[model samples]
Target chain A: MSLSDQELKHLARLARIHVEENELNALKDQLGRVFKLIDALQAVDTKGIEPLSHSLSLSQPLREDKVTEIDSRESYQAIAPQVEKGLYIVPKVIE
Target chain B: MDISSLSVKKIKQLIDSKALSAFELAGLYLQRIEKLNPELNAFITVDADKTLAQAKQLDQAIWQGESRPLMGVPLAHKDIFCAKGWLTTCGSKMLANFVAPYDAHVVEAFNRSGTITLGKTNMDEFAMGSSNETSYFGAVKNPWNLGKVPGGSSGGSAAAVAARLAPLATATDTGGSIRQPAALCGVSGLKPTYGNVSRYGMIAYASSLDQGGLMAVSAEDIAYGMNSLVGHDERDSTSVKRAEEDFTSQLNNPLKGLRIGLPEEFFKEGVDTDVAQAVEQAIQELEKLGAVRVPLKLPNTSLSVPVYYVLAPAEASSNLSRFDGVRYGHRTKDYRNLIELYEKTRAEGFGAEVKRRILTGTYVLSRGYYDAYYLQAQRVRRLILQDYLNAFEHCDVILGPSTPSVAFGFNEKTSDPVSMYLSDIFTISVNLAGLPGLSIPVGFGREHLPVGLQLIGPHFAEAKLLNVAHQYQLVSDWHQQLPAGIAQV
Candidate 1:
């Protein structure tokens, strides 16, 4: 689980977070240390045990296919960094 | 008497009896915040205009003969919960400018109960840090000693209540965020069973483990407040559908023949001597109140920190993915493309601790490491939960020190991640097991700072935990003891 600088950069990219050269060494060391702690989970034999995604053993409840929420697009989009004509403005995706 | 010295229940009674107007009490709280927030760094934002307007409306309703138990009692919210039109920074640059457009279910619940929102309290960046130092706003100083940290990410809430900036505060617990801070700051906080409190509009850190709770002066006050907090919300699919029960109904339950399990693991070498003594003395008082202390073993206790670090961060990584330069959070000032925008925005927005966690989570959940770390942690989490279930068979509730030590000095554990992670050694297991746990000011440790006694209970046992804490509080004055400048100020 020891993350090299390259591996750390890969993870940062995968997580969609930009990492500068100065910050990479620190994050690489810290994330590696955390992973080492997490490595303790490996010693326990878990052959038959079911992994729990949620604490409750209850089955997930399904809801009816109905529209329960009102559209508040204007309020929701008001805080976006860049918006124009009721549409969020981002860098051009296609040439 | 100064309104600052009164408890939430007492304030409610006076407001109901017309002895005090909600407006005046709100003004007193506002004044206290203005006076104390600079030293304590508890409240990140306190809008006097918004607070007084809400109080005036509540006063108007009183004139119209409408009253509620929590009516007009000003309360602070952890910056994590979204309250429409308030700055909802989860102690990060990411949401520093993001004012929530809608209310979290918890906020709406308090709003429904007529409670006044004083402002948002400081917390760790996305509820990640054990010490409050990780907050973007600044570290919350413990009121007991200004140099010591109020534990986080609910640090601000705990410090606010301890300093009497507000009578109570709403906090969320994920890996001991609520209880740890409450313990350090010497107040009472409860983390209700997972799925009990609705998570809608609560900024998610670890979806599976985060549970909203409250920090107040007493378990009775939290219990009184809990009735409004725990409700089924369709919006949050994880919300459990359970019959409404009064969390305070059994506050006077006699502790006679109650089995209080003391897990040998919790009292081991890692715990400070002073903390152990305070907890033992509190357990002795419980014995006097008819509780029979029982020795028990939760063998998998040591695995809690490792398992929680894996799972919580895994969930955090996935959950935080939504914060990419889009919808309502901080976006980088310069970016050439959409992908660049996403990366630069997140890197700039998140703090170092948060970025470290996101990196940790991404590493663990990545294609190669998923089964080894993520799956293994989940399996171990089940074992941790089973250990508690087994212990509960021999005892009514398990009791131990809420934190391994009292509030440590600032910058003490910051450099070492493992050291900081161990701060949550006692409280993380409860979230892992999906059970309810509470931290109460059992006694003071070094330098007269608070040491909390954690009471862990089975799933959906909030009422019993509250009852146990209430009975202990009735026999003791620790929960009543406030930091030096807080009392009758």
Candidate 2:
């Protein structure tokens, strides 16, 4: 159940985290132990068991087709890292 | 007399009787927070101005002849809940400067009932850790002994209530976050059934497992909060549509012929003898109250830790992905590209324990491991729930130790993640079962630290659990025992 450095980096990328060189081995060791612990679940025979997604049996409740919220763009945008004219400013991804 | 010593009901009664004003009561708690919070580090944010304003509003309402169950009672909220105009950090560096623009459903419920906000208590980063040590704000000390860790991520709330800084505080349990701390700090906490309380605006740790609850001196206090806290919200789709219940109304339900199932698995290996003895004595007290003990077995108990780690983190990976640099919370000052911006902001923002979980979550839910780990854990979760249902056929409630041991000092289990995960062994199965579980201070354990006796009930059976807890509380003095230093404060 040992995770390779390459796999750790792959996980870090998928997780949107940058694993520094020094932190990689430590992260690998810690995650390896957790996976080992998780291995205990493998012994159970869950052949026909239905996966429980949520505790409740209800479907997602739908609301009326109307906007119920008051406009609060100013308040929300006030906390954004970078904003201009109420638009969130992020790095340009495409030309 | 300090108002912090009174019960939630007592406080409301005095306010109703004109013996105390909401403003004055709020002032007393605020002064205590100002004086003692430096040593305890329980509160992350306490706004005297806003709290006083809330109390003044309640004062005006009282003057206008309005009466609410929680009126004029001062309380703290876990940092995990969003309250507009207050810093809701969730004990992480990421959201340290994040002032919520809205109130969570639980916060709104309290506000509607006229509860004055004392402050937001500290928690583990995004409610991820068992020990409160992982908070970016630094660890919260157990009020009983300064060197020990308060069980977390609701440690701040537990500590505050234990020290009588506030009468009660709002808490949430993903995997025993509420109950574990309640046990460690000698208070009562209840994690209601999934969907019993709306999760709207409660910062999600694991969307499927996280349920908001309360920590207080007694089950009666919890019922007082539950009256306002429970309701179906269209905003939160999972909010149960069940009929309303007066949780306090069932406090005196006779336990003459009640059935209490003792889950043999909960007291198996790894539980400290002292903790088990304390739990045994507490249950024996229930037996004296005429509860017939029924031995039950939840065979898949050991798998709960592994199952929860897989499922909770998988949900968290999806939930926390929204915390990219662009929106609210911390952002990277230096990054060349959008990908780098996302990576670095999160890398710097989240603490170690949160990153570990996010990474673990990402790993299990990643393309190849999905079926083997994530789906398997979900299947195991169902089996675990089935275990509780099967056990409940023979009994009305289950009793066990809330934690394996009492509070441990800082750095005791920090080096190994699995050891830390094992602390919630006895309590985790309840969350996986989606049952209502509560922790009540039963007696003192080794090191003179408090031990909690856990009582779990069928889903949405909060009133039953509360009634059982209240019956025990009526005869026990453990919940009434505050940390020695609290009296001087």
Candidate 3:
């Protein structure tokens, strides 16, 4: 139920959050406690029980696959951190 | 007139009778926020000119003989719902500067119902924590006891309604956000059956469990608010399509042969004595009103917190991946690569509780642990829901203490995450079952702070829950008791 510093580092990388060396130990301790609580679920016999994905067991409702939205790129891009010529500018991916 | 004490219904009557204009009513609430918000930290964003303009427009409509259900009543929006042209922060540093270009479905519905926006209330960072302490803006103080924390992530909304800053505030419950804070701050809150309200523009935290609801001075006001909030939305796939509901239709229904479920697990060892006494007395009052109490058992109730932590975080980790440094919200100033940009922005933007959950979610859903944690929790979730399904066959509604105890002082449970999570023990199961639950002030608990009684109803049974809560409010004046200094204001 406890997370090692190396595991915590890996988790932060996977989750896309940066954790400092000092914060890692404290976070590990707290997360370890949360995991201890979650560990209790392992004891419950859920064999053959369907994993309830939705509370009411609702199947995805469908509609005709047609454009339902008005194009509002300018309105949406106005809030982006970096946008140029109506396109989002992220760090270069091409070599 | 003591405008602060008026309910949504009373506010409507005043405006309708020409005793007050919508513009004047909005001004009264705005003035109260200006006076009281400094100490309570209940409001994160308040634009007086904008609010008054909307009110003035409504007044013009009234003058032109046009009327809507809740036309002039002022309401607070939990920062979680996006309000077009308003800064919708969701109580996170991540969204601190994000001005929404569109309104959430609930926000649009409220506007369509003719309510004037008062302001956006504060909340926990991304609705992650039980106490308002995790909010990036600041923690909201309980109206009843300024020193104590307001149970949250909907703490500010609850505190605002309790302090009479707004008669009603839109709130959401992923776990117990709405009910816990309402219980702590001494107001009425209702979390309808999941998918009852659209989640189109609500900042998602645990999509399956998140539900939009209301906080108000009384259950009747909550019913009034609900009338405007429920409807199907094509945008939210999970939004249930049903016959249009009149949420207030059953408010006057007598409890002559009503069956009230008393779950033994909820009343067992851990609940504080004062809360127990208050809940017991409230139950007696319901019995006197002709309700028959049925003893019930929900053995899986003990596992709710554990199951919630696993499932909620797993969903949160996936939902929050959208917060990369690109489209909206806070972005890192220094980053060399796309991955660095993602890591740095999230690291800088999310608070500790948010980060903790993301990390926990990542771990639980990681390669080897997904089945052991995530899948197992989902199966257990069914068992938890099954417990309620069984109980409902024997009883019409389930009643219990809303929280284990009254509001605790700031920092009392903040340092320990599990203790903070346990505060939501009684309320989380209701969310897992997709059932409508309500919290109403029943009596005072420790330090003479307010205690709340929780009522759980079957799926889509919001009318029954509100009817029971409104009946209790009829016999008791607990919901009417204002915070000492606040009443004088």
TM-score of each: 0.99, 0.99, 0.99
| Model 3: lDDT of residue B186 | 92
Q: Is candidate 1 or candidate 3 better by DockQ?
A: 3
**Which ten residues in a row are the worst by lDDT in model 1 chain B?**
B480-489
Off by over 4 Å in 3: none
DockQ of candidate 1 (2 decimals): 0.85
What's the candidate order when arranged by decreasing TM-score?
3, 2, 1
CAPRI category for model 1: high
By DockQ, the best candidate is 3
Q: Local error of candidate 1 at B117, Å? A: 0.6
Model 3 C-alpha lDDT per residue in residues A15-55, reported as the tens digit of each score:
99998998987898899899999998988999899988888
lDDT for residue B308 in candidate 2, whole number 0-100: 93
What are the candidates' individual DockQ scores?
Answer: 0.85, 0.86, 0.90
Against the hidden true structure, what lDDT does model 3 obtain?
Answer: 0.93
**Most accurate candidate by lDDT:** 3
